[model samples]
Target: MNNDVVVIGAGPAGMAAAIQASSLGLKALVLDEQPAPGGQRFRAIEQRYRRLRAAGKGLPASEQKGLDLIRRFRESDTRFVDQASVWDISPGGRQISYLHHGRSFTIPANAVVAAPGAYERPVPLEGWHLPGVMSAGAAQTMLKMSGHPVKGRIVLLGCGPLLLLTARQLSNAGANVVGLLQTTGPADFLRATPYLPAALRSATLLKQGLQLLTQTPLVPKVFSLTQASIIGADHVEGVNYRSRGGSGFIECDAVLLHFGVIPNTQLSRLAGVAHDWNEQQECWQPVVDAWQETSAENLMVAGDGGGILGDEAAEMSGRLSILRIAHRLGRISDQSLSKLAAPLQRGLKRLAAARALIDTIFHTPETMLIPSGDTVVCRCEEVTAAEIAAANASGASGLRHLKVQTRVGMGPCRAQMCSMAAMAMITPGIRCGQRPPPPATVRAPIRPLTIGQLAEADVEI
Candidate 1:
């Protein structure tokens, strides 16, 4: 189907983009992998909101805001397809390919907004492959979608606001939170002090973060963690950790890990969009302009897919990205676009002021980024850190070379889970003024699909 714009997510950014596109008199089609709207940050908000309301309970402030956005999206004239997994976008952003209901379809669009969002940065440690060891985001997803806490004694480890938030959520959900382990310490906070003034500009966010820290369950907490390993053979038994204060082991059935989040750049890269390494966030993100338009003519990346901006900023950036598309399509005049974009730009600037401090304070520990010995860096391929190190030592120059040498990123997940860690291992140090290696190459069939499914794809050429 032909449309003015196709939005490739249903999160805050995607929803906001579609809503803005419709307001500008443009037909927008939003394709999202979730069964409903509200991306990971607000996963299953609608269903949970309804259930809680019926039970005479109210949703969290953040979730209620997400539900409000979802309601607006549902009320808009823009069309949306849920449970649609977009696997490819033609170069130059002219066509979209997605799988829905076990069938593949290609559609033409004038412009595409990629808001694939972010995923938790993987922290590869010993025995992390054990069952019941998952990312904090995964645990949060379980809590949000099903209102069920993860079973048994749990140890929440790693850094980032999400770690604390997930711990609080799980604790409130009646999970047996045995311990909280933080990789960040006083040194990181000291490093972040320079950015505190800017962060203070968003007092509401600071207050919320403080609340999360103080209101979390009173459990044994360890800070300045240098290393962690799951002490399990088949399933999670406990977590062995080392911190500045001391080293200890926490008996737990589940270990939830979180370091931070990185942009989901697979689709953007597949579309041949140029990306640059964000030194601050220590991840590769699609290069976008002030308006969120990528190097490709009509493709834009919004929200965390472009970079790890929070959900509120994602919504603002999403609206900002569509303003340019709407203007280019003649749906809005120059003056109209300028007027419409002014407030969103202001909001984005305000939200971004705090990101520096957040990134600094929660920077992924160096040890976790480049694990050594038998730690499995690539879970899908079972590639260990020593294998990657050995390959790099044997002349694996970059991501491509490493992939060829050791198959570190050729797994079913297509480097999504392992690329960052592998890159960390391959390039342990970079000389000053030297450009870091480009991200792994992205190709079609970004998501796995059967050969028969590809052959039966409905083409709209």
Candidate 2:
């Protein structure tokens, strides 16, 4: 199938793009991997959709906007494909390959917007793989979407609004949360404070962190807590942790560990989009202009996939992307769209300023970065911290050396998980005074496509 514009994700950004495109009289099509739209933030929204659908009621305000977008596309003959995983996008001419219902299909669109949001970064603490140990966001998605019961007694670890929000959610969900642990160093926030005046002019959003630190005295606290390991062999019994001045153990069945999020840009790299390394967020995100356009002429990206701006920014980015898309398609002039969106654009600018303010107030610390000195950086090959150390010591420095010597990033993920952590251990210029490993080399099969699926996929599309 072909269309004037194809959005590869059904998240807020893609939905927004689709809406803008449809409104501007362009034929829009949206393809997504999930069974429904809303990306990660609203992935749980399907239950809400079912309930609304059952009641013969339309979507609520937020969801209604999304539904309106989908309906507009459908009504105008624009296409929407769910369970369509666009694994690879061949650049230049038009090409996209996806697997739907175990059958491969391809679509060539005149323009594309990639809104494949970010995912949790798995920082390897000792025994991180033990049951009950999960990313804070993962547990939230599991409980919210699947009704899966998380561990009974939980300790939410990490810094950011996410930890506080997750702790509150789990508490509300009936998990007895002992405490919400914040791992941010005060110095980090201090470093970020200078950026705040610009970030917090209006957004009271992260003000919660500062307020929690003062009031209740129990709700939220910022301190660095290093975990030795999650206790218990089969499951997480508790966590062994060490902090300044003393070491102690927090007895709990589960520990929700979240360092932060990193963009899932495997597909973009495969598509040859340029990416900038956000060292603070510890991930590589696509580089997009103010218009959300990427290096490729016909490609654009938005949201956390572009950078870690969180949920609100995600929705706004998605919406702005479609406005930009309309301009690129020649359906609407840039001046016209910008003038029409002046109010919304000003509001977004204010929010962006506010988010920056709070992120500085509660940013995660660098000290909590991946542990070095014999810590296992890669889990796939059973490679140990000692092996990585040896690789670093043996004149073999940098990620390539670590890979050649320790086989850290050579696993099934081909370095997605381990590369960031490995680089953390091996500081740049440690080897030959050269730059660090360039982003992992990307090729076809961005994600694992079965042989049968590959066979069904035609290159011509």
**Number of the predicted model whose lDDT against the real structure is largest:** 1
Give the Cα RMSD of candidate 1: 1.3
Least well predicted 10-residue stretch by lDDT in candidate 2: 213-222
Question: Candidate 2: TM-score?
Answer: 0.86
> Which residue pairs collide in model 1, if any?
none
Error of 1 at 230 (Å): 0.9
**TM-score for each model:** 0.98, 0.86
What is candidate 2's CA lDDT for residue 306? 82
Q: Which candidate achieves the best TM-score against the true structure?
A: 1
Please write out the lDDT profile of model 2 over residues 26-58, one tens digit for every residue: 777788988877787777565757765898975
Error of 2 at 310 (Å): 2.5
| CA lDDT scores, all candidates in order | 0.89, 0.70
